[model samples]
Target: MKPVYVIANNIISPLGDTTEKNFSLLRQGVSSVRLHEAGNRSPIPFYASLFPETFWQHHHTTFTKFEYLLAQSVNKVLEQASVNPAHPKTGLILSSTKGNISLLEENAITPQLKAEISFTQSAKKIAKHFGFINTPVVISHACISGLVALITAKRMLEAGLYENVVVAGADIITRFILSGFQSFQAVSDAPCKPFDANRNGINLGEAAAAIVLSVHKPLNDAPILLAGGAVSNDANHISGPSRTGQELFFAISNAMQEGAVSAADIGFVSLHGTATVYNDDMESKAITLAELQQVPVNSIKGYYGHTLGAAGLLETVISICSLQENIMIPTKGYSTPGTAQQMNVCTVLQPIEQEACLKTASGFGGCNAAIVLKKQ
Candidate 1:
């Protein structure tokens, strides 16, 4: 298989827009969550950790939310990678669970807005923003969408479909999302405390992230190799998490097998610790079944809140920076352990030197994905 290298990465998250400031603050274990705007929440009293709307206004050349985020993140990653998309050999992959959903809502209510925000229109706008003559393939796989995009990009690169692949994932927190999560009782009034005994559900947030993959040698960032990854379906429940963790175990095992690594070789596990009781328990079971219970695990939700579809990309970007800097941020708000399971969840922030990290994420559609990354 052709090696898929993460040549460059960038994130626009609740903590900060640039990777540098965010990484420093993350290392310090500081959280950016604040009470949500008065009218923006449900009875659950949602919290929002967001970059200023004004901060992205200048970058958002289009009125569509997804296009704006996709363009902004893509621009930053491309600039850092020094990859000129003006070349024809580059391919773009856009990922989001709710692509243009906000716009669709508005358009449905206001026909005049319909002309601006269709899904295809949003994808086209992003492609045009990067000056790419080729249309980009858009993937919407719920919360695991970003990781799936990265996996897809790697496959395409290995197949010689493109020399350089621009993979981007972005999503905005909207009233629709707030109400939906609230309907499921998944929104927490307090800042989320992943893996904590008294932990509530997730705190929704918005973020956009972009990652560049290339077959050629990367510059100096010590780009993590996208060694291998796998996606699996639980098929156990529609909304409830699988207690057996059968699907998650399959995903972890497949990823390990593809990368030719054992569970013991994984330095750390970037868990899908969403803090929900069932989710946390299921994840713990999965880790044990994979025989990776001893691996240190942490989640970034405490810092950025949960960015839903954008979480995988945002977390992967953070993981890459942590690998480069050699520090691991704590799973903020985790005071007491919640999972009555085997794995030792790394609650407190700790610094460590490691060469590989396995990032995992699961989402609404019974979808679970795991990606193993080796330090460059």
Candidate 2:
């Protein structure tokens, strides 16, 4: 098997356009989340991190908004890497829970445009735009889509199925989405607070993020290896995670096993930490069960809101930046420990000599995933 490395990455969020800009804003503890008035997005007022209309004005593309956002992220990443999308040895993978779902509300949906709703079709169009020859892969397994897509990319690179793979994930905020979460009472009225005593629910947001993985090392910086990844399911509930968190713990254990690292070797853990009551509690148990209770942990959901499919990829990119800068970003809206198990939830930005980091995510339908990254 070949060693896969992250060559470049890009994030299109309310905070900024590039990974560096987003990292800078996060370093300053700036959050784009705000209380949004009830309009076309939802019938009731809710807090969310939404991009201003001006953000779209900068991207001049003929593709639909969702497609264009994915392209914009990929374009930025391509600028940072030497990989060629037009080459035969390259592949593309897209992740999204909802793709162009907003179009269903339009007055008339033409047959041609209706195809955009299928995640695979949208991936094909985006892949063609970049001249990729292989059939594009699409993953839409709830919020875990992004992390699973990345795991697939790593396997592909290591198997030598492709020399370079562009993995991107995105989801737009729409009435359909807001209503679904609202029905479940999962929408927070204010900014979401992860791992806090007063935490309520998650704030939905929209974003597009892209990463380029390659077998070859970059010349400019130390290679960041996509060390190992593993995923598991609880088989307990569709919308809820395992009460024991044993499944998620299994994922963490399997991921570390694959990376050939022990819990003591992990510097920090980037958590799913969605501000919901059940999620934080489950994760707390998982971390403790894995014997990583003392490792500093932080979640960026408060900074960008729960961006659906984009959440995992976006958080991973930021955490990769954290590893490079030796800084751990604070949990933006956390003040007190709220989980049943005691864990080191970071509350302030601080520097540390991190050699490896763990990223974890759990979503709708009993799905759980964990991945490890290491500096070489």
* Over 4 Å off, model 1: 40-44, 56-61, 109-116
Q: Tens digit of lDDT per residue, candidate 1, span 1-376?
A: 9888988888887667788877888878788888866664444456877667676657544456667777778889888888878678799888887766666445455665664655566778778867886678888887889899999998999998889999888888777777888889887888888888898798877888889999987766576799889999888777777878889989988988887788767778888788788888889889889888888888888888778768888899888876777777778888787785767777666665568888998988689999988875
lDDT of 2 at 90: 92
Q: Which residue ranges in model 2 land beyond 4 Å of their true spot? A: 58-61, 109-113
lDDT of 2 by residue, 1-376 (tens): 5788999999999988899999999999999999988799888899998889987786564577888889888888888886788888898999999888988877377786677677877888888888888999998988888889999999998888899999999988989998999999988888999999999999998999999999988875667888889999999998988999999999999989988788777888999999999999999999999999989999999999999999889999987888888899999999988898999999988886658999999998999999998888
The per-residue C-alpha lDDT of model 1 at residue 32 equals 83
Predicted structure with the largest lDDT when compared to the true one: 2
* lDDT for each candidate structure: 0.81, 0.90
Cα-based lDDT at residue 343, candidate 1: 71
**Against the true structure, what is each candidate's TM-score?**
0.94, 0.97
lDDT of 2 at 267: 82
